[model samples]
Structure formats: structure tokens, C-alpha cells
Target: KILSYLDDSGSGRVDLGMFYAVVAPLCGGHLDKRKRVAFEALLWRPVNEGGSSQITKMDAVKYIKLLRAIYIPSQGMSEMLEVHGEADDDTSSSMVTFNQFLGMYDDSEWGFGIMSTVVKLETRDRNRHGNQVCSVCRYPIIGSRFKEVKTGFSLCNQCYSEGKVPPTFKQQEEYKFREYGSEVEAMKAKCVCFSMQSHKNPIAT
Candidate 1:
């Protein structure tokens, strides 16, 4: 269906507007107005250069590569595929079908959460302790304002209070506090995992 939109020029190319029309549904209208502008920046190509203002199949490949770098450069494509076991065959066509693209996210528990660009509170864990540190800030968490998540990671209160924690790493709640011998005691409590939160209000990616 996206290929069909490239028919606008009858030249086997898709303009920025046409491409956006094809992808708008995937975005679910959650993109902000400013974000739309940033997208234009990503889509734009100098006409004076070899390529035209419109996007061709080759141009789309280049854009996808750049997008991959911006979004998931930390995780190599091969590593991600291996971890998720999404692609069974080692060798496949470079082109991705629409269903394949959607399936990539559908297959993972946290894939949609990361792709949606909204972080939700993770479940709490109590049984684990010691030498745990905030993944984001790399600070100590024991005997201070500390919290642990299902990931078996700890974060200090200062980082949480400062709002420095990314949504992906934020805990839903801290350990429950109990008064013991004039000191506050924190006990690890168990909580069930829940669904990801909605990003009806999108933040700039």
C-alpha cells in the first residue's frame, strides 16, 4: 500500500507528503507539531544534489539507516534480532513488509513500550539488595533514598527527586517503609507486572 502511494509521480518515487500519508497511521497522530517539522528535516533532500525532492526506494533505505542510528544505535541490528528471535532466517531481503515491521514490535514484551516513546513505571522487587546502583546515574542506593525495580536495579532518591530518571528505568513505587528501633526500615514488596502506559501526550523524540 505504501508503494502504491509512490504512483503520484508515475516515476516510482514518493514525495515527503505522500510518505507521511503512508506513515501517519503508524504514528497514530501522537506526533507533536514541532515533531512534524523535525520529520521534514529528516525527509528533506536537496534537489540540487543527485536526488530529487521526492524519495525513491534507495532514498528510503538511506533514511531508514539514519533513523536506525538515531533510534537504536546502541543495540546492533543483528544483536536485537538474535535477542528477540524475530527473524528466523539469517539471510532475508533488505526490504521489509508492512506486516513485518509491525510484527517486530508485536513480538516483544517491551518493544511496544520503547517504540511508543513513553516510559511506564516498572514493577517493584524486594528480595534483592546490595551493591545495586542506578543504571542511569550510576550512584549508590543503600542506606539512602533508594528504590528497586523488577529489573533488579536500584536508583537513589536524589536522582528520582530531580526527575533525572528516564521513563524506561523509573520504578512504579519504592520499598514500603516500616518503623523499627527509631530507624526507618524498607522491606522489598512484590508487585504484579502491568501494561505499558499510553503516550496520548507525546514528548519530542
Candidate 2:
């Protein structure tokens, strides 16, 4: 079927030229070193079973099936399908080449990014607890006061507001903390000072 169409040499395997013709359009262009290595690994069947760097029809078909299964919105099959439609009918015919397959997998790495985010969230949750005291300021986390993360440590609201935390603490999350109307005057005062400083010192172009 698809293997016969892509084989080109009538040997039941897709060779280098045939492989390139199939993959080039889908990979968004030529395969780079890393992409080529990944593609070979993915389509490589055991040499003992008549497999090699050159992909057999069966292996190629399986690879294409997996590519079509990639359903991540705006990332996987949807994007690849658009490429497929534009390619020549003889080569693509509902199948992508090794590099194309790898390209689709790489695009799906956003899912992995989300998984990494989950790990970060878990670490945050494990560190968070009710009645936890700020490691830096030694003050209780209470009322409208919240804890801000520092370099492997926590800072109380007052300490954080005073810029006591280090620059490395960039991560923040949506925290449910109470707000105080009394802080409005303090916030307005800080804003006025910032405005005054900005007006006094014009930045050099």
C-alpha cells in the first residue's frame, strides 16, 4: 500500500532519496543533525529482523499512523495535515516521512512543558502549608500579608514589599490572600514617589 508507493526502488524499503522526498515538506524543511538522529531512532527496526537505518514499509506505516494520532490543538496533526495537503499526492498520500514524524513529535513538546509545569506546581504545593512562617523575616503568614518566594526561602509581606528578597525569586502564582483597604494610602504614596523619581531623572537615550 503506502510502503509500495513510497518504496520507489521496489525493494519494500524507503531509501535515502525517497525518504527525503517524503519528509522535507512536513519537517518544515530539511532535517538537521538532531532531527535526523531522532528520525533514525524512531523508524529503525531491528537489523536482525531485516531492519536498518533505512525504514521498511511496515515501520514507515506505523510511524505515519502515530503521527496522525498526534491531536494536540494547533500543534500536532492539525499543523502537519496542512503541510500534507500541500505536498505532492504521490509522496505524501496520508503519510509523512521520518523527519516529518519527528517534527510533529517535537511540536508536541508543549505537552512536556506542561508536565514540567506540573512538577513545579507540585514542588510549590509541597512547600506551601497553613500557618507557615516566613523563613527570612520570621513573621507569621496571616491576614492580607502573603509569603513571597526568595532564593530557596520565603519572605513575609513586609520583607517582600521592602525589596528584601533576592532577584532570583521570579516565579509567582495566583494566591488567595485577603486585601486591606488601609493599604490603599500606602500604595498611593509609593506610586507618587515612583512618579516623582521618574520625572526627576530622564533616562539617557
Candidate 3:
């Protein structure tokens, strides 16, 4: 469609204003600025006629980027951003898209990488013992050290059992905790598995 706008005349390629008019209707007033620019440039440029005033793909790309910079960002885009959470442009999204010309679309499903930090309040035992230290091994009674909890006196697994090794090391690559008491699951997984006191109950993770 953009190719149709290219003016093959010797005057040179038309500006984004010309392209904007060309794409206004096609975009239905919601045209992603860059695409709108490309459609116009491709349509008005005379390059295809005889390569006489040919504009390279790079030329169209430059204009589209410019439009993106100037285009009034929609509140809808911001709302979508809030709902979807902040992410990198490369991340998958339902409302974000990028074009071959490097133009970004609000409706693109791509997302960006956005690292975040979270703080959590955690206790050690299923019993809700906020201050209880294990009787035997004195393992730290915290959500972070669940696996070390033992039957006899909340002793360290090493002290509680006959041997410090697992029943069978053959199945998995043997891993060890610094000190046993309770296990903390991945934060994301814990959101569902472990319950919060007010929200649910921060029981055994």
C-alpha cells in the first residue's frame, strides 16, 4: 500500500505529512504512527518506477521511527501497560507489537524485560511457630529452611537420621541445604502454594 504513494517524479520522496494523509483512513484514526508513515512513504515514493528516485527500505524506516517519537501516546496504551505489568518490548504481550521497521504497536503481544524485587514475611513451621527453634539440631525455624525439620526434636536432617545422605542419590544430582529446617519454594510458585496469614495462611511452603 505504501508503495502506491511513492511519487515517481523527480521532486524526490514526499514528507510524512503526505504519508499521514494517505494512511489516515486506513488506520481508522488509530494508526500506529510508524506504520502510518511507512504506508505513506511507500505509496508516494517514485523509486519503484525506474529506481529513479528510489527510496530504500531504510528511508521508510527512518520516518516511521520519527512518527513514533512525536505521536501522542494513548491512555489506552498506558492502561494496558498497567494491567499487563511493565516488561521489555521483546517480552510477549497481548497489547504490544513491533514491526519490521522497528515501529512498536500498542496491540503487540511482545513484552519487555522488567526485573522486580519483592519482600515477604515468613515463619518456619507448619505449626505457625514464629519463634520456635528446633529442640535437637537447633535448625533455624524459618520458611527458608523447611527440609531440615526432623521428627524427634526438630533436629537437622543429618542429626535426625542414621545417615546424612538421601535414600537414593541415583535418581537426582545430590543437592544440600546450608542448614536444614524448612524449604522455601520459588517466589512465584509460593504465591499459589503457600498461603499468607491475612490473605490465606503462610503455612508450609
Candidate 4:
């Protein structure tokens, strides 16, 4: 199903650009790149199945609901989809063109927040594990764990959401964390840093 959606050219094979258009949105990179990829994903359709490229309000609502399912799981789907009061009388206003969608990112603060959350959730590892424990709660980390770069402090998703940090470290007004899927990945990053440093300052006999 995803392949069909991405194969806009209707060719049996998906080209590198086509594949990147759909996959980049989930990989959590530059915000502009993610936004562009997302916009393409929403507008894409096989050339054989020609249709308007503009996304309707309903389309936007459905995408929003999918995001809500991850971040706001407690909220019922019906409640999220419900339209408040009467529907918009202006029919044309309900459609969002590519330019209009881009405008939302430029004009709305929450625009960046929403897209960032979407990328984070899509890229997160949903697998449960006990290989590592959260530094704050001392519980086995599940899914994605957030680690502070400066102090090597880690937090489980719940603790991160609640803004919990290691008691030894002073709480800051804001915290920056790198999300990792597993302890091995964190270790690999450490090893890479070590290798780079070693290259820069090689030992002399």
C-alpha cells in the first residue's frame, strides 16, 4: 500500500528520489526537509489515478488524528475528528494548496512543534527492553530514551515527558536531549567520538 502511494510515476520500481520523499519524513532530520517530504506524501498519487493535488480540510484532519493517536492516546478518535459548531460556509477556504501549507509553517509557532513531534514519534523504537535503565527513574527504558549530551544523563519517555532529571544535576529552564533507540546505539556513538578524537590526537612513540 505504501509503495503504491509512493510510486507516483506508476513504474514498478521506486526511484531514489521517490523513496526519499516518503521515507525522509519519518527519519527526523531538518524541519524544512521533513515538512517538504510530508507535504509530498500527503499530495502524492499515481499518475494513472489523477486527482487534485490540494489537500482538503478533511485530509488535514485525518493526518492530525493519526499524530494525536501517538501523542494523545487517551483522546478518542471521534472526539478528535468532531467538527465544532457548523461547518465552514466557504468551500474554497477548506482546501490547502502547497503554498498555503508552507505558509502555516512560516506563520504558526505550533507548526514546527507539531511536525517535530510527528518525526519523533515516527522514528521512535516501540520495542520494550531492559538493557539499560533510566538515569532519573532507575527503571528499564522502553521505546526511545532521551539522553542529555552535556551530562550523559538519561530519562525514560515518561520521565522525559514529565521533565524529570537526575537529582544530582541542576534543573535548567530548558533541556536538550538526543533520542536513542537502544544502549548499543549510544555506545556506538561514544565509540565513534573516541575514534574521531584519537585520529585528531594520535599517540607518539
Candidate with maximal TM-score: 4
TM-score of each predicted structure versus truth:
0.23, 0.25, 0.21, 0.36
Single out the weakest 10-residue window by summed lDDT for candidate 4.
83-92
lDDT of 2 by residue, 75-137 (tens): 444433343234344543444466555445355543112323434654554344445565556
The candidate, 1 or 3, that scores higher on TM-score is 1
Off by over 4 Å in 2: 1-31, 47-51, 71-196, 199-205
- Expressed as tens digits, the lDDT of each residue in 19-64 for candidate 4 is 5443554565687777677667666634212577776554444444
C-alpha positional error of residue 164 in candidate 4 after TM-score superposition, expressed in Å: 1.5
- lDDT, each prediction: 0.39, 0.44, 0.37, 0.62
**Candidate 3 error regions (>4 Å):** 1-18, 21-41, 51-55, 72-205
In model 2, which range of ten residues has the least summed lDDT? 174-183
* Top model number, lDDT: 4
Clashing pairs in 2: none
Model 4, position 27: C-alpha lDDT score: 63
lDDT score for candidate 4 against the true structure: 0.62
Residue 164 miss distance in model 2 (angstroms):
15
